[model samples]
Target: MKKIYIEIKWAFIYSITLLAWMLLENTLGWHQERIADQWWLTLLFIPFAVFIYLLAVREKRRRVYDRKMTWPQAFLSGAILSVFIALLTPISSYIINNYITPELFFNAMDYSTKNVGMTQSDANEYVLLTTYLWQSPIGALAFGLATAAIVALFVRKK
Candidate 1:
């Protein structure tokens, strides 16, 4: 419980930072909620990245790689961390979509459609794909591995 509390606190801190960044960078500055909408996409990385970062280090230093946790263990915990993002992302999305300024979504969608050199259908498809793709297991693996590797380099077991 102590270990988990430590790990999650860092991840949540980074996640909140990212969220604040999204609010400031996308909607407030450029008035680009569509791009900002995608910012929530990072919610996927926050928990997985931080936890795997710490866990991989601990696992390696303790010489427990031989007893490595199955991917299921890493992934299940990652999913739990992301749940925070999932809950907050949609509510944030709603506030941006409905309250802050409705035109931002339309503007972003329009900009994406025109600049991508794709038809409306394709652009819409891209948006949908990009939105959910970050949360997939593949994304988790990619981020988790990269983060874990870096943290592992510095890990020292107790």
Candidate 2:
């Protein structure tokens, strides 16, 4: 528990950053009038995600491992951080979908059915809050682990 203090702290930071990004997207009209551009614009979050992972692993290496961390140590620390992020993703998603951008699903469904050729049923199934409730945590884990792996390689000292 003591050793993972850094990971826990970084996990909160990552979750806050994710929420901030969603707020930015909503403010930019991506959740409504600019829904068409939302998909690509959202992908821009990759850099922020990677940077957060890098910072997490680097902090763990510097603080927990005393600057002598190996690849495995960094990777484990990041994996733990990823787990924390995964655990928090549902709450973040709930807040974002329910509060920050309540109309996002409807807008996405509209775009999907009109421009992307998705049937209404398909769009409904794909774009709802329940769907995001499940997808968000899975996506967070998958992306977080992948980011952790790559970031571990770079942050590892020896």
Candidate 3:
């Protein structure tokens, strides 16, 4: 536990960052008026996510390995961080869906049914909170591991 404290800390930071991003999107009308554009607009968060992974792995390398961490060591640290992020994703998503942008699912369903030609039932099933609660953690783990793999390469030191 103590050995991976940095990963835990960074996981919290990433979760907070995710909340902040969702709030920003909601403030910019992405969750309502600009709901159609939200799908593509959310891609903008990729860089920020990668940056956080880079920072986490780099910090682990410096603090735990004394600046001499190997690629595998950095990757392992990042993988641990990714697990932490996955564990926290459901809670973060609940906050976003319920508190930060309560209208998001409704807005998405409306847009999908009207513009995307999705059936009402399909929209309801796909856009609901339960789906997101499960999907968010899976997405976090997949993306987190991928980001960790890449970030590890760059952060690894001799």
Pairs in steric clash, model 2: none
Residue 102 shift from truth in candidate 3, angstroms:
0.4
**Tens-digit lDDT track of model 1 for 1-75:** 643453355445544554465565555445553454454654554664465456534543334333454444444
lDDT (tens digit, per residue) of candidate 2 on 72-139: 89889889999999999999988998899888888899999999999999999988778889988898
RMSD of 1: 7.1
Misplaced by over 4 Å in model 1 are: 31-105, 129-141
Per-residue lDDT value at 77 in model 3: 87
Candidate 1's error at 61, in angstroms?
9.8
The lowest-lDDT stretch of 10 consecutive residues in candidate 1 is 56-65
Candidate 2: where are CA atoms >4 Å away?
none
What's the TM-score of every candidate structure? 0.50, 0.96, 0.97
- The residue ranges of model 3 lying beyond 4 angstroms of the native Cα positions read none
**Per-residue lDDT of model 3, residues 75-116, tens digit only:** 898889999999999889889878999888889999999999
- In order, how many clashes per candidate? 0, 0, 0
Which is superior by lDDT, 1 or 2? 2
